[model samples]
Target: MTDTEIRAGIAEVARAHLGYEGELLDDTSLVEALRLDSVRLLTLVAELENHFRVVLEDGDEAGIEHVADLVAVLRRRIG
Candidate 1:
């Protein structure tokens, strides 16, 4: 998938998992914007992995603070 498609997929997963009703911007902070707790964040990560079919290493968990970061990681893995 292209970067845009990857971002859209991740955003959709976020919206669904976090119970967001409105649109999500690319740069939105998952913690601050979605108010996700640690458990929810971990859930989001698992959902993204399922969506993208990519295994996330423990070190990779550090860079994912926002939707943009998630998109970036997906892009790198998909590439």
Candidate 2:
């Protein structure tokens, strides 16, 4: 999938899991902006992995501090 599609998927997951309706900026912190706890974040990860058919490493998310960071990880995996 393309970056746009990956981002859209993330946004869709955020909408479904976090009740987020606004645009997700690059700088949007997943914890702060989306209010995602560990469980919700894992749920999002699972959904992304299933949709993209990629096995996301635990380390892949270590440095993911923002929505853009998450998109970058997905981009690498999907590409």
Candidate 3:
């Protein structure tokens, strides 16, 4: 799928699982923008994995700080 589709899926997962409704830009900090606690963050990750049908590495979350980073990771995994 395209990056735009991945990004849209992320937004949908965030909204459905985390109650996040704001716009997610490339530079948008996941922590700051989503106000995510550890549990919520994990939930988001799990939902993203399920939504995208990709198993993210344990280290994947470590490198993700912004929406773009998550999109990049998913793009790589999806490919």
Candidate 4:
């Protein structure tokens, strides 16, 4: 998938997981914007893996801060 498509997929998974009713911006901070706790983080990771069929790197788990980070990570893995 292209980067835009990857980001869109990530946003869809995030919105579904968080029950968010609005758009997820590129710069939205995951922790501050979504208040993602460990369980929710795990769910997001699992869903991303299932949705993308790509395994996340350990660095991704630790480094993701904004919605864009997911795009960067997946772009590297799948692009």
Candidate maximizing TM-score = 3
Better of 2 and 3 by TM-score: 3
Which model is ahead, 1 or 3, in terms of lDDT? 3
Once model 4 is optimally superposed onto the true structure by TM-score, how far is the C-alpha of residue 65 displaced, in angstroms?
Answer: 0.9
TM-score-based ranking: 3, 4, 2, 1
Sort by lDDT, top down from the best: 3, 2, 4, 1
lDDT of 1 by residue, 32-61 (tens): 776778888788878888988888778776
C-alpha lDDT of candidate 1 relative to the true structure: 0.77
lDDT for each residue of candidate 2 in 1-79, tens digit (9 for 90 to 100): 7777888988887787668898887888888877778787778788778777899986898889988899999999887
Question: 1 or 4: which has the higher TM-score?
Answer: 4
Q: 57, model 1: CA deviation in Å?
A: 1.1
- Candidate No. with top lDDT: 3
Clashing pairs in 4: none
Q: Could you tell me every candidate's TM-score relative to the true structure?
A: 0.81, 0.84, 0.94, 0.84
Flag clash pairs in model 2.
none
Pairs of residues clashing in candidate 1: none
Candidate 4 stretches greater than 4 Å from native: none
Choose 1 or 2, whichever is better by TM-score.
2
Per-residue alpha-carbon lDDT of candidate 4 for residues 11-57, written as tens digits (9 for 90 to 100): 78877876755666778787776678998888888888888998887
